[model samples]
Target: MARILIVDDAKFMRLTLSNILQKGEHHVVGEAENGTQAVEMFEAEQPDLVTMDITMPELNGLDAMKKILSNNPKAKIVMCSAMGQQKMVVEAIEAGAKDFIVKPFDESRVLEAINRVLG
Candidate 1:
């Protein structure tokens, strides 16, 4: 299983994602509370995959994704989105995110998206 870094402003959301990925046998290397932290964590940890939320304080997921990709094009990412963030989703893909998961998350869908992106 791949090593994964989870990024979300909400602590519970990050924990939920951690639990889901850990159960799926992916190593949860770290968690980030905001997009700026996400980018820093990604650079330091260099995990096999990252699950990033689209909206956050300091910097949004798309900008974080761009920074990460700018540093490492091969870095893999999946955006954690909310309903009706289609525009952000497109921006994420363009920024080099491999996939996305919409919130209020379904565990199965979360796992599926992770697998599709990093499996």
Candidate 2:
């Protein structure tokens, strides 16, 4: 199982993702409420994967992804974006996110994206 960091401003969303990942046997190493914290955790925890929300205060996920990738080019990230953010999602892939899961996550799709990226 992969070690994963769940980054979302909303505590509820983080909890939802944590449960989903745990049920799939992935270790939830840390939860970050903002991009800054996410970057710090990325360095400290060095998780195998990260699920990054597209929007947040302090710093957005796209910028955070860029920063994380700048520090670790090999980092694997899966963007967690809302339904109307297709533009951001595509940009994420271009900027090095391995995959994405649309918001209001579907368990199967989330797992599938994770598996694909890990592979």
Candidate 3:
């Protein structure tokens, strides 16, 4: 099972993602409420994958992705975007995010993205 990190500003979103990942048989290594915490937890937890919300406070997903990637270029990051954030999603991919999942999370898509990234 891959160690996964869930990063989102909403507690409910984090919990929902955690439940899904757990059901998928992946371990939820850490949960971060914002981008800063995401970066810090990434360092501490060293999770195999990260599901990062695009619009978080302090630091956005793209910036945090950059930070993590800078430290570890092989970091597998998946951007979680809400609708109408296509531009940001594209930017994230360009900025080193391995893949992305749109909001109103779907279990299948989430797992698919993670599998694709990890593979």
Off by over 4 Å in 2: none
The per-candidate count of clashes, in order, stands at: 0, 0, 0
- Locate the minimum summed-lDDT window of 10 residues in model 1: 110-119
Cα TM-score of candidate 1 = 0.95
Q: For model 2, where is the 10-residue window of minimal lDDT?
A: 16-25
TM-score winner, 1 or 3 = 3
Best by TM-score: 2
lDDT string, candidate 3, 14-46, tens digits: 998999888888999999988999999999999
Which pairs clash inside model 2?
none
Better of 2 and 3 by TM-score: 2
Question: Model 1 segments beyond 4 Å from truth?
Answer: none
lDDT of 1 at 78: 93
User: Candidate 3 has what TM-score?
Assistant: 0.98
> CA lDDT, every prediction?
0.90, 0.96, 0.94
